[model samples]
Target: MLANRVSKRLLVGLQPVFKTPHVLPSSYLSAQNARKFSISSKCYQEQSPEPSDGESSASKKKDEGSRYYVPSSQKRKPLSRVTIGSSTDNARFRRASDTIEFSSWKAGILFVTLGTGLYFFFRYQKEKMDLQRNEESNRGYGKPLIGGPFNLIDQDGNPFSSDNLLNKFSLVYFGFTHCPDICPDELDKMSACLDILKSKYNIDIQPIFITCDPARDSPEILKEYLYEFHKDIIGLTGPYEDIKNICKAYRVYFSTPPDLKPGQDYLVDHSIYFYLMDKDGEFIDALGRNYTEETMAEHIKNHVDAFVSKEIREKRKQGWFSFLY
Candidate 1:
């Protein structure tokens, strides 16, 4: 019975020490035991204090981390403002992209312009060189080096000289009547060009064929051979030395073929070119084998037209001066 009472007192004392809000069963504790429990409760209450709001928040941050935390003063921008900022940035990017493309286009145009300029520049230089060559050909070795005084027998056995070239534009060819292919072809082209010039441009050019092989090409032979060719062409033949001097003076190269036998008829190798001579026996131009009859006629027409225009201008100027006087 005493042991039961002591156990009851121990339970009641522990209730006060625990400070539980629930009501305890009736019990009685010894004074010493109750005093000891009260002292232990007071010491525990003094040692452990309530935590502040700051300390609690710090502990929460340590446990859950700062990722979920948001400051009270900071707030999100509205949807409209965010959208406007993004749109402005996109517009700037587009403008930058367009500017780059425009610059690239301008650079490409500049490159093409430079390339075209270079192409035209080179073409102009090439045309200038061709013009210089034509000028040189027109001038010959110098002023009037090709045509000069030469007394030779024509196809009619009449004497012909540089005087015959006065007041008439002449087309001269140096070849042998015995030339199988080259001379015939060139003479035919000359005849065709002459017809075209006369009919189309009213330029009646006199044609002349001077023989390089005078040994075989007598005046009678030349007349007979030229009969089958153009009627207007006059054939000229002379002594070997005279013909040689004429050829040298005109810069016409001619040589006997290497395969010539002592008695066999051989061909004459000669430089082929149609010499266009103005009045007064001045060389105007030399047309090469590459020129067609039509091309030659056209070239002659251009020169004749230029000459006629120049004559008209000079006449007008002279008339004005005479009137003034």
Candidate 2:
């Protein structure tokens, strides 16, 4: 009985500690209410009905709670289909691109063509200017220092003087009919040159042969000798003093034996040059043994083409731009 009483006292002491069905704290109860409210809000949102087209948006807003509700101003709008450009705009853009491409192609061709044309034009102008300069350099100013008036008898025994040389170009050569090699060769070259000038350029030039050995080469002898080379060549012979004067005037050097016996075979030494005289009987140029027939013809042609009359030159000298002439 004493043991049972001790056990009963122990149970009574523990009962006070485990009493009133273990009531929870206020903080725990508030947390449980918040959890239940969140779960209910989620269920309401999920179970809400989609509004019909005839349903008023105001009524739908009124059914939602403040925590989940959104104002009309803050609501997101539905996405709309967007268009960039119209078909007409695309077609116009394509046309513009094609036009630009075509125009660029045409412009490139024009640029190349224009550049080539300009290049050739400038090149031609430069060449023409150079030719003009060359012509001017060859055609000197003022009267020539070489040829002058002289008198001599022709192969036909006709009286010819410097006046006969007017209105034509003349090539004068001082030689003797007794010349064995050099004179004949030079005469042949001159003949060929004359033929070329006449046939190719249609320019006429007079060829004259003056005798250094006047005593041996009489008018008849000269005629026969020159006819063997070219019918165009004219032979001239005169007195010894006249021959000496003519040679001195033309600046030709010639020598014959001082004292020669009659019937003595001798060769006269003379200068080898063909004097080119213009229409005015003035010296223009001199051709040596070295010049070829073709080259000599070309030189004569150039001189003829560049010829300016003495009257024209004197007229130009009176002009305001005389110095330039």
Candidate 3:
């Protein structure tokens, strides 16, 4: 009875400690006994939902994390603003290029349109002028000479023209002294013909040798080359255009090498005919390349005498001494 009373007294005394406002140890305290209870309770709490009663902190944290995780463009890590900014930069560049292209295209179209308009306008005016010119030309007679004013350089590097041959007839031949087969042979035949003309009728005439190969025949080159031929034969050379025009004027045929490759030498094939020009520089006769000095003179003297009176022909034909007259 006494033991029961003491035990009862101990239990009643412990109830005061248990029921009173005693300070509880923190959950982090890991006494050997406390650690066992903490592990078991932590696992249990993880399995169970955390209490939402009273405290909003847990819910606030969950809301914050979820906000960051929410997908903007289908859960991509990159943000919508970042994607938009990159896309915007690309779009801006494209827009700038497009603007430049549009402006350039617009300018081109405007220029082309303006040019077309002007071209048609000038063309219409030209047609009207041509019609009036045709009517006026029809009122007048005579076939106009088919030729344009040509600029050319002569034997002495001076400009020679029909004016240079004024008061004198010209014997224009396309030949080069270096030409082994045709040029020298043809020139010799011409010289023989001229000699025959000298016997029958001596005329103050000019024979010109134009080079086919300018690379080998400048003014200096031609001067030395003509020494092999008749002393009276004048040599001529110039730039390509001058040579081309001179040849064209006399209907002399000459062509360039298809490709003028550097460091390669090529030959030219040209007409072998000699041209006879009147005192006015009009094309008169084309002599055969096969003519000898006798035959050539035979053809020339008659024409020279035909153009002038007998007295004038006699006086002019006395060449080299006619100046004495």
Candidate 4:
């Protein structure tokens, strides 16, 4: 066998003075002594040549299958694998993070809801106080005045003469069925305001819509138009001269375009206003434009509250409460 002087030599302890027989000598000893003894590494400093510049154990490992190596049959230990989580475990962690994000997102919505609730609460309370002030301060009609009145017809097609509507609070306006937009919109507002009045404040005020365009808004037209807006609204269309006199009495100005074609697009120029009257058929205050539905309803509700209180006072004086039996 060739000597392995080119490789790094393993250290051997030469007990220079031997006490045990299984001891080893220096690497210079013959191969016969290499396997003949076991040595304690603590007792020796191996003698090696000055190593070449790049020669390393790794480079020496590349010398496998050279004339020096003797392969061993021992297998290396298998690597240890420590698993952390299953696939579902990762998914559940992601879901938990999503749930936290969702909770934070909905927290903003809850804050907005609470802020809106507080705003409404303050606005509602302010409106209530204003309504009370109006009911107490304005003794007649509790709204602005816009027009006077004349003889008219009721919803039963009966004459809604001044004598009939005089003993109650009245809201009056003038428009015709042939009006393109303004009439229907005004009447609808009045109806919507009244519906809110009845439901929210139990006001039962009378409303009248007298036709300025009597040529097209006949009693039948008036009836159908009234039905389209509100059941309680009374409509009237009488003789042209009489209606003109009524218009003059209420100070309502209306005129039709001169060159209108048959069933053509036409409009009636009239003052848009609300005329509020007292229980004595007498014109009082009125409300002009720019007031919203709730504000208008508030005005009427205040008037009705005053009117009802007066009625109750009078009835109490007459001992009417005893009739509950």
- The candidate that achieves the highest TM-score relative to the unseen native structure: 2
Error of model 4, residue 86, in angstroms = 99
Which structure is stronger by lDDT: 2 or 4?
2
What does candidate 3's lDDT look like per residue over 226-253, in tens digits? 7667777777777777777767755667
Q: What clash pairs does model 2 have? A: none
- Clash pairs, candidate 1, are none
**lDDT by candidate, in order shown:** 0.70, 0.74, 0.58, 0.61
RMSD of 1: 32.4
Q: Sort the candidates on TM-score, descending order.
A: 2, 1, 4, 3
lDDT of 1 at 160: 92
Candidate 4, residues 104-135, lDDT tens digits: the string is 75868888899999999989766665554454
Model 3 misplaced stretches (Cα beyond 4 Å): 1-151, 308-325
lDDT of candidate 2?
A: 0.74
The candidates, ranked best first by lDDT, are 2, 1, 4, 3
Give the 10-residue window scoring lowest on summed lDDT in candidate 1: 76-85
Question: What lDDT is obtained when candidate 3 is compared to the true structure?
Answer: 0.58
User: Which pairs clash in model 4?
Assistant: 144-285, 144-286, 145-285, 145-286, 152-160
Candidate 1 lDDT (Cα, 0 to 1): 0.70
| Candidate 2 Cα outliers beyond 4 Å, as residue runs | 1-144
Candidate with maximal lDDT: 2
Greater TM-score among 2 and 3 belongs to 2
